[model samples]
Target: MRTRTEENPDYCAIESAMEVLGGRWKLAILKQLTPGTLRFGELGRALPAITPRMLTRQLRELETDGLVTRTVYREVPPRVEYTLTDAAHRLDAIMSQLDTWGRWYRDTVRPGDAERVT
Candidate 1:
């Protein structure tokens, strides 16, 4: 699928960024990797709501976007791990700001609407 960034050369730079990180799960995945490397199953455990299939799909997209690196170890059980790339690390401050804003929104704007927010 051709994204808006690809089809419209005149699109804003933010559009290009959103193309890679705007999805519901991409930011979450990146946030999970902020601490350090984690295996596929470890990621799944952290994000209990995401199915194995969806987790795999999001990880693949993150890898394609150069936000995450996937490494495979030829161990006895064949281990695989993922780590955030330098580009992704650069967003740490931004992500922290977003988290603070999200907390404010949930607390002030939608305090009693937890059911609908979910």
Candidate 2:
């Protein structure tokens, strides 16, 4: 299979990266998964705003993109866990930078509402 850069040499890298991480919930999900593996219910509880269907879709997409791994255990009640892959771990630095930029923007550019809340 041709790699993205090989297939579309002219495509902007940022656009390509956004294609994989654009959705509202994907980044949040990735942030939550950064700590360690979590079960379906655990993820759901952690992200109370996400519906079950949306969470499932986001997880499947993340898995397809090789960012996350899902394992199913053989047990009477059944157990499943999701964890970040090595490639996903590489995103930690980027995400942390983004988080810093987000805080800066919130404090410097758009401060009133967030400041009031804090």
**Which candidate's TM-score is highest?**
1
Return the TM-score for candidate 1, rounded to 2 decimals: 0.86
Clashing pairs in 1: none
lDDT of 2 by residue, 19-81 (tens): 678889998899899999999999999999999999999999899888999999999799999
lDDT tens digits, residue span 1-118, model 1: 6385565456577878888888789898898999999999999999999999999999998898889999999999999999999999999999999989888786767656676553
Q: Which 10 successive residues of model 1 have the least lDDT summed?
A: 2-11
Q: Report the C-alpha displacement of residue 49, candidate 2, in angstroms.
A: 0.7
True lDDT of residue 66, candidate 1: 88
Task: Tell me the whole-model lDDT of each prediction, alpha carbons only.
Answer: 0.89, 0.87
Please list all clashing residue pairs in model 2, or write none if there are none. none
- Regions more than 4 Å wrong, model 1: 2-11, 111-118
